[model samples]
Target: MEDTGIKIQPTMYGIFFEDINFAADGGLYAEMIKNRSFEFTLPKTGWLEPNSDRHSYNKESGILSIIKYSEEGANHNFARVEVNNDEGYVLINEGFRGMGVKEGAQYDFSVKAAKRSGDIQKIKLQVIDSLDNVLGATSITPDSDSWKTYESSFGVTKTEMKAKVKITFEGEGEIGLDMISLFPQDTWKGRKKGLRKDLVQLLDDMNPGFLRFPGGCIVEGRTLAGRYQWKKTVGDIENRESLINRWNTEFAHRPTPDYYQSFGIGFFEYFQLSEDMGAEPLPILGCGIACQFNTGELVPMDELDPYVQDALDLIEFANGDTSTAWGQVRAAMGHPESFNMKYIGIGNEQWGPAYIERYKVFEKAIKAKYPEIIIVSGSGPFPEGDYFEYGWEQLKQMNAEIVDEHYYKPPVWFREHADRYDSYDRNGPKVFAGEYAAQTMAIASPKNKNNWNAALSEAAFMTGLERNADVVYLSSYAPLMAHAEGWQWTPDMIWFNNLESFGTPNYQVQKMYATNSGTDLLKITEDGEKIIGKDGLYASAVKDVNTNELIIKVVNTLEIAQKLSISTEGSNSQQGNVGVLTMAMDNLEAENSFEQPMKISPKEGSATINEGRLEVEIPAQAFSIYKIKG
Candidate 1:
């Protein structure tokens, strides 16, 4: 295989993050308590006051009462417990499908409390199982007249996936509590407040180009008021108000009413995660357009000022200095040095002239203030459609920096469209294949599987994505994660339950590409022709300047093995060991499971490549990469 001589951009492959399927509150954000703030519409949704019905305020030992703060704020609710009698009164929090606790691991427990009256001397926080068996226990003595924070740590003696945090008090009269929280002491990098170590580790392994924060339809909420507000997501964790996730209602196949964004993993955390992963930060802001799939609500043009301003303020928040207001907030957040964010996306999967109108305002405001900052525009939901074309045309006319395109289609569509970007204009807005997936079944179907068939097709298509690296600047797989039992969407790149997470076969493909992405893109052709599924083969070549090696990727989407005989046009080099990574499966439906995460993962092989041209065998339904020193 020979190098094609094109340069693979550093921002070639990335990842898209959204809170759908409990990705944030349940999956990434380590806050174990659900409805922690009592702010949900159904304030007691995750709370089990079985003691409620058993005991009334008139005759019971204790009862819980809801307290509301000023409606103008994000943290607007707290629970006030009137403990007439301290014994036998219990408040239980059923974590997201029960908190995942590990034996021997220490968990930090904290709560905000104000002694309204009575001598509520001690508050016991215990990680208890379904039958009330304690796995871990810690007690805090709240001493205060005004609201005060109480903290403690408990070492788990036992592990329980469905453990609840049981709260019991001693010598109590009445007390106020808000932001009751429990976090595993062992978070990613041991940060006091951080992301799930396992999940972040998977992303870290990918070496992603950029981390796109707080998004998908979450950016464009079902309604403007429900949209993700970056301002609310920043600041003190306790004050980072909660909101009904845009996905809290009904999805095409699932309804998870309990879903909400804790903002534990907010804009600041996202930037930090990007910094930690050595990836760029790309934040997408709402353009005042609600999800087109839902209400399709559009903020009136006159009322669009705030939305545009949010984009402007975000740029400052990310890159400005303490001299500026928003930038000062970033400094206070502990990252005084700018995140150096170079790109901001205006909308998510939006279309029509309304989008164009709103986009222009944001684009102008952003460019005028920070012309060096690049803005990512949208080409709507589908890869091919009237609105997609319209978006491209309009953005091209505007000389937009980059255009985001999303596609959720069948596996066949991906393989057939390997040449999708080859015909793109050389001088038009560069492409951002922002969100995409090769669905095993129909798009977004619960039955869809992240099988080898779908993954291999994406690999086949990715050949073209790499082949046209000059036109495609950024790309990523969509809806990055899903919590198994609570998911509303299927076919996520990674899936996790309360206990563990595993990358799907698709994730392996993404990881392989990102980790081995060469510095220079090159054409790998057979008989002077591009190999885009010709003879069931799709291939792309590149030269890794740092490693001084030739990297060739070949995908065989056929039923049987095919032999490849190749020769380099201008290369004459000695035989070198070819490091081969092949991800193959005879059964198209094969997938990776938590029990056997690497069952369908890539397998490494050593091949000796002779001086000039190379010959290799491509497996059926497999994606292979060959790296040979030049």
Candidate 2:
């Protein structure tokens, strides 16, 4: 492998973040309770009142009810408990399938309360097991007449993933409680109010180039009225309104009625996360069209101005000066400067003449206001066929900067289609493989998998994406995460429950390519031609300008090892000790588990170059990266 002299763009390997499969509220938001603000449609979805059993036996036990304030603001609802005695009338918070607690780890418990009447003397907070045994306990005595904040801390003696937060009042009295919150002190970067440390660390390890967020179909809800409105996702957490997630019902696997967006990890947090991870921020907004999979509703062209305006306002919010209105809001959120966003997308998996009409309006408005901002247009869900071809044709005519494409096919489809982008026109709108993963069963099937077969196939396809770096500018795996028990979709890149998280073999493949991505593309050929599934091997080459190293990736989706002869043409002074990282599994279905997350992960080794060329053996069912020093 040697330098072909083609330059790979900095935004080649990135991430796509969507709020599906409990990825936001129950997974990444760091809040233990499911509906902490009592904002769900049921208002009591995640809460369980044990008063039915105990109150019947003793009338002294209290009854809990909800109170709703004026609906003008976000924190419009709170829970009210009327207690007659300390007979243990309980309010239990069934966390996202129960909170994950660790032994010797401290947790912070806080609440907002006011004493309206009665001797409501104390409020005790305890983390209890399924048998009602207390794991850790902390109490707060609220003697104030107006709403004020209360805080306390406790440490568990044992680790448990099915732990619940219990609240019991002492003495007879009337109390108002809102925002009963609990957070693990050990968050990512140890920020007081932060993301799940383990989950963020996995993303940080990838060294992603950019982060495209607020996504999938959530940006375009089933109805235009229910779309993800970024205006409502910024500012104070308590003030950020909650909405029903479009994926709340009728999923391919599990249907979650209690699913709602608290916006705890909102747009502001997304930009901050991108900054923390040292990646560019790419935000997608609605374009007046609802999800085509559902309603396929469209806002009349005459009334599409607001949707276009949202895109303009977002660019201002991300890269505006403090003197501007939206920039003032960004500054008040503690980031006085800017997110420095470079790309803005109009729709997700959208196409057709209607999409083109709306996209044209958005393009003119966005470019008229901010010419330097790159506009990412959309291609329909399927990566090929009439709609995809039509989108590319129309977008290219419009001189669109980038076009987003997505596909989820069988593992064989990936390996066989390694040259999917080879025929793409070099002068057309560049590609953004925005949402893609090799499906083992079917699209979003509960039985689908994140097995080694899918990973290796993806690696095979990625070589083609890299080989066409001039046209394919950005790529990412779809639906980045899922919760084991509460997930609606399978085959996610990262899997987690309440306590622990692990990356699948697919995730390892993504991380390897992203972290090892070089600055320039090179030619790695056998028989003086590009390698594409010949001998069950796929290969691509690149050069890292910063490190002065030439990198080559090889995927062997075969049952036997393949030996390659040395021939680098060493005329360009490309030579050195070859460092190889190989990821292989005995079985195609072999998976990474919580106990052994890296079971099928990459393994590093050194290979001495013979003379001027590097000779190596690629193992069966493996994806390997060779870093050659220059």
Candidate 3:
């Protein structure tokens, strides 16, 4: 191994989080109650009155009506529920494909309610299985005439994956309800309204370097009106208006019309999440252009000021002092300190002359104000095309600091293109392989699987990314997590059902690289040339200055085991045994399910260094990392 004198950036291996595949509402965000604010297009989409007779309205046991606010606002609708004959008048909230609850786990439930008419004494909430067995129960009395917030907590008797919240009214009267929500008390950091513990734990375990947020096509919605607005995603949760997710109707085969962005886990939460993971917050903003794949709508050049202003305000919110307008808003939200954000992406996968025009406006405004913030520009959606060529050429001329590139190609493409960035201009803008995945099938195909073949190939390709760490400043896989049943996209990094979640083979590969990503680059070569799938092996080497350790990553793509000796050049005799982490699968079709999450995970082994040379036998179809400590 020869020292390359190239420093690997701290923001090298990071995360790309988009709300597709119910990742936010149903997966990461721990809120169990869906349609919490009754703001969805179909306000009662997740609610059902099992016993009420629709034809008999108020004549039955009870009836529910969606009342819109006279003065239009974000919290536009409230449920006016009237109880006639209080005989099992139950309102059931079918959670995001049913709530996942563990036995003996406490869940906090809250709701805003007002006694509209007669004596609606109290509201009883219970967690019940599909068979109507109540596992947990809590109640709150509604004694106020004006809006009042009630909170209660209860513990479930048994672990249930498909438990639904059954709400019942006591006494015969009417009440207005809004923002009815439920969350597990054992959330990440025990925050009342917080993220899922297990899911966040998985992300934290990776020790990611940076977090790219609210993104992919989400920044540019299907139409200009639906694009993600950082302003709308901040402030009070009640006022953060919900929007139909751009992925809601993108795919016809796996339609997710119910998908929507509640913005509960908004921009502020994204920054907090980055802080929690010790990751640099990289928030991508809208550039006054809708997704080119859809409408390709553009905000007239003269009218692009609002979009540019959002980017400027966001920087202030993230790093400005409390005296500033946006900074004060961030402080009032419980975080007085700045998030210390350093990177901002102007657009997401947008291209053409129109994209360049809008990006120019944003660039000018942002550089004029927050000149220190490094701006990330896009190079279209695909890696190669007329639009991609034009976008790269124009961006190169503009002297952009960083340019984002995306590609979702077949597994073979990944293995063959290990030198994808070898020819990149050393003086040009740094590259961010923002969105990439090895597709076993076609891109976004429902048939795609997160199999060993794809993961192994990606591992082979990542060596190239690390090899060119000087130019490739940042890299992350797309569509991070997915709800097994509620997902529109396939082959996601992590898959979770209502009650359980498991990292895919792809996730295992990412974790391996991220956890061992060293500080400085080193050359691991054969005959003084870099190894790029020579004799079925691909490798990269790095040294962690902090740990005083050398990390060598090798991937064997062949169907047979390979033997090799790595000689540490110009080094004193090592004192400790080499730590070996092997993740191998002879079956390329192998995958990880909830039942076998660690099926494809790394297995710990050891090796000894003799005469400044480490001898090891690499398994077939595997990715291994050998850590040598001084």
Runs off by more than 4 Å, candidate 1 = 1-5, 54-57
368-477 per-residue lDDT for model 1 (tens digits): 88999999999999888799889988999999989999999999999999999989998888999999998877876889898988899999999999999989999999
Return the lDDT, model 1, position 300. Answer: 95
* lDDT for each residue of candidate 3 in 1-630, tens digit (9 for 90 to 100): 777899999999999999999999998899999999888899999999998887774557888899998556788899999888774688999999988889999999999999988888889999999999999999999989899899998899999999999999889888999999999999899887899988999899989999999879989999999999889888999899999999988999988878898999999999999999999999999888888889989899988888888889999999988999999999999999989999999999998999898899899989999889999999998988898899999999999999999999999999999999999999999999999999888998999999999999999999999999999999999879999889998879999998888889899899999999999998888997889989999999999999989999999999999998989976553555999999999899999998899999999999999878998999999999999985
Error of 2 at 617 (Å): 0.8
lDDT (Cα, 0-100) at 130 in candidate 3 = 92
Cα deviation of 557, candidate 2, in Å: 1.4
Best by TM-score: 3
> To one decimal, what is the Cα RMSD in angstroms of model 2 from the true structure?
1.6
Regions more than 4 Å wrong, model 2: 53-59, 571-575
C-alpha TM-score for every candidate: 0.98, 0.97, 0.99
Least accurate 10 contiguous residues by lDDT in model 2: 566-575
Query: Global lDDT of each model?
Result: 0.88, 0.88, 0.92
